[model samples]
Target: MRRYAEVKTANMLMAVELSRRSKGQLRSYSLHPGMVATNTVDKEALWPAFRQLDIVTSDMKPKENGFERWKTIPQGATTTVVAAFDPRLDDKAGTYLVDGNIAMKEQVASHAVDPVCCLLLE
Candidate 1:
């Protein structure tokens, strides 16, 4: 999680710098698909524990389950599309987005910002 966050931060910073240097209207954003039908849930070690926990919780609906939901892809895509194309977002650089909403600012640890991980984002 920390590594992923760092890579994302670096990518956003890079986008901000690139837009500034080019004098173009641009914004940087990030998103997480809450739950979509993907093999990652079945295959990723990181997700199974959470998936099992969700199953155990009666209040956790199938729509909320990462492995079961199909509608989330389109819903999740909206956030990115909005961030990229919405005129209201113009000049809003260095913003983190989640689930189509502006994300709260948080400090990320330096160790997570591995150059190798940052390069992967490129």
Candidate 2:
């Protein structure tokens, strides 16, 4: 899990670097898919790990949590679909998308975009 998170952060940083180097000729993005139910999400295997955290929702959407209704695999693709085709996002390259829109300012990590911290990745 630690490695997973580190790799995700690295990928986000790389997307920013790639976009910057391309100088408007290309674009890149990062996203959070939230939780999606699929074959890959083996409840049996994950149950033990999640049991420790105690926030695991049942195998149902809208499970007790008021904010999110867990999405099906197809439903989970909406953000990607929008990111790929949405004209509104054309000006928003190298940004993080959540729920089919650019995440708000506070939604982004302050240190993630810092050039000083980015140097450590090299």
- Kindly report which residue stretches of model 2 are placed more than 4 angstroms away from their true locations once superposed: 43-45, 53-68, 120-122
Model 2, residue 113: distance off in Å is 3.0
lDDT of 2: 0.69
Question: What C-alpha lDDT does candidate 1 achieve relative to the native structure?
Answer: 0.54
> 21-44 in candidate 1: lDDT tens per residue?
456655555454455544544444
Residue 56: error of model 2 in Å?
3.2
lDDT by residue for model 2 (46-90), tens: 664444444355652234353445677887898888878998877
Please give each candidate's TM-score. 0.56, 0.77
